[model samples]
Target: MTLPSLLKRALADLWNDLGTHMLTTVVIFLSALIFSFFSLIYFNLQNFVEHFGTELGLVIYLNKATPQDRIPALYQKLAGLEGVQAVVYISPDAAFKRLASYLKDEKDVLKGVDPKFLPPSFELRINRAVFHLDRLKRLAEKINRWPEVTKVQYGQEWLNKLKRFSVLLRAVVLISGLLLVLSSAFVVSNTIKLTVYAREQEMEILRLVGATNGFIQGPFLIEAFFQGLLGSGLALAFLYAGYRYVETLMGASCLLKGVNISFLPWTFIGIILFGSIFLCVSGTALAMRRFLRL
Candidate 1:
């Protein structure tokens, strides 16, 4: 048959089972929507984890009796240290002010302590490219031995735990995504199987007439492609509406706290749509393989 005739036959067959095709499409769309939702959450969590990790650094406290004239020299030394990005000095008054802000709910407690009791400190940010736990620990120990230095503190244990949790989150996302894809593919394949089974007689006839398996499967694949496209489109629309409703409810609260709540990026949306199309095509091919065994 000519190319036009082949396409005409494929279109006719696909049109004959509109109801079943549509049902399959809806199932595929829902699956894609769920996957995209999970991905959106994963990306946000990943962003938070990275930000927290990058902000992790050491705080160096100077002795309370340390002279003010020596601070600039100490600051210069710290700034010149290898792996140190910058050192910001915090005066006793500033420290006390921050303490008050942190304990604002219990203002009466601050009345008991003198602001002079607060020591000066330096916030040390390290070069991210050279950050190493062992190296940081050794540097902290060395700094602690300085005559003017009271202590060097970094949340080493907490940072280790945070890093581990980030790894665990990635693993969980990967496993969950794989399971979702497999389950979605299974459901789509079963749905396509029904259509293939219904056309068994036609497929057999085409096979007997020397038509290749590709020719016989062309219409089914075409139908699946359209089903994937339409399903993903519908899914995206619903996701957008749901996201808007959620934003209206929570966006203000997040912004008030200087936090940002965001939805999935357009790139990811594209991935979901293309992934849905791929899944449907794969499912249809798998279904055809079994039925076209003759």
Candidate 2:
């Protein structure tokens, strides 16, 4: 049969089997839901990593009496250090100003507090790749050993625990997403198998009249493809709507800010769409293998 004629028959078969096709749609929706949840977590973890690389809280506070000219040499030295990305000098006056602005509404409470209370500090940012806690703390210790340096800090145990927690959660999310994808494929295949079984007699009649296996199988293949594409389209729509809802609710939080939390990426969408179609085709192919002997 010509491609057009075969496609027409496939559409008719799909319409006749809409009851069975709905199960595949359900599977797609479930898979999409799972993808959205995992994607959000992964994106947030990546954002936190970026903040550590640039806006890190590693502060090297200098002694209050450290001279102005000495600051430049320290900044230059720190910037050229092994793993440093950049070193920003914050004079005591600037630090005091920031402290005052941050507590702008508390001016009455700051009446007797001198700006000298705030230390002259240098903020350190480093390359993300070299940011292991042991190396960073060791670097900080080396700097503090100098008589000019008062202290060095980078969240110590807090950073350590956050890194570990993020790693663990990422692993769990990856495993969960993989399991959901596999389950959806299995469900789609089973649904396709049922449809093939239901239409076995029609397939047999075509074969009896000298139809080739290709002719007998062409319509089923097309129907399976249509079902998969339709289901995938539905899943994408639902996933996008959910993203909008979450963004609205979490707009005040940086967790979703600057992170593209929309529908899954096109690459992922393609994977899901093609994956469903492949599952259906394989399911139909294997089911017909048994009964094609007739």
Candidate 3:
């Protein structure tokens, strides 16, 4: 048979067993949707963390009596340090002013407090190229030895926790995605196997009439491809609706601020679709292998 004839036969067979085809497609759709959903979350979280990492750094507080003349020198030295991106100098007066603004409504509370209570400091941002835990620890120790410095504090515990959490999230996404794909493939394979069994006599007749294995198998593969394509399209549509619903539910209070929690990008969407088709085709191919001897 020609290519067009084979495709027509495939469509007819798929439609003839509409209930089973629909069931298999639904299973594939749900699996693909879940995989894409978690994948998007994982990528979005990675992006958020990378951007948030800029806020992770050391705050070097200088002594209260540190002279103004020496402040510029210390700032220059800190800025020139390896792995340091930029050093922001906050004078005691400026710190005090910021505190006053925070308690602006309670002006009486600041009546006796002196600006000297707030010490000058340099906010040190690390360069992304060398933003490692060991580097940060060594830099903090070096800064603590500065004669003009009073103390150094970096959010080591929280940064480590965030890194660990990101790793855990990725592992969870990977394992869950694998399980979903396997489960869906099992269902699709069994469904296709049943369909093949139902038409066993017809396939046997074709084989006896000089039909090559590929010729007999072509329609089944084509049918599986259509099932996968339809399933992926449905999954994407459902995901889009879910995305909109979530966006609406989040309202204006999403703590992510500038981050977009929308659907995955086009490239990821293509991957998800292609992965679904590949899984379905593979399941069909496996099922056909044992029956091809007929």
Best by lDDT: 3
- lDDT per residue (tens digit) for residues 72-119 in model 2: 888888888888887788877788778788888885676777877877
Model 2 lDDT, residue 274, Cα:
83
- Clash count of each predicted structure: 0, 0, 0
Off by over 4 Å in 2: 48-53, 63-68, 81-86, 108-114, 125-150, 155-162, 249-263
Score candidate 1 by lDDT: 0.80
- For model 2, what is the error of residue 231's alpha carbon versus the real structure, in angstroms, after optimal superposition? 1.9
As for lDDT, the candidate ahead, 1 or 2, is: 1
- Determine which window of 10 residues in candidate 1 has minimal summed lDDT: 45-54
Model 2: residue 248 alpha-carbon error in angstroms: 3.5
* Model 1 lDDT tens row, 1-294: 456776777678768877888788878777777777776667766665444444767899999999999999999999999989988999998999998999889867989688877899999998877776667778889899999998898887776676677677777777877887898788888888888888888788988998888788777777777888889888888877887877677756755344445778889888888888888888889888976777
- Order the numbered candidates by lDDT, best leading: 3, 1, 2
Pick by TM-score: which candidate is best?
3
TM-score, per-candidate, Cα-based: 0.74, 0.79, 0.84
TM-score for candidate 3, residues paired by index: 0.84
**1 against 2, candidate with superior TM-score:** 2
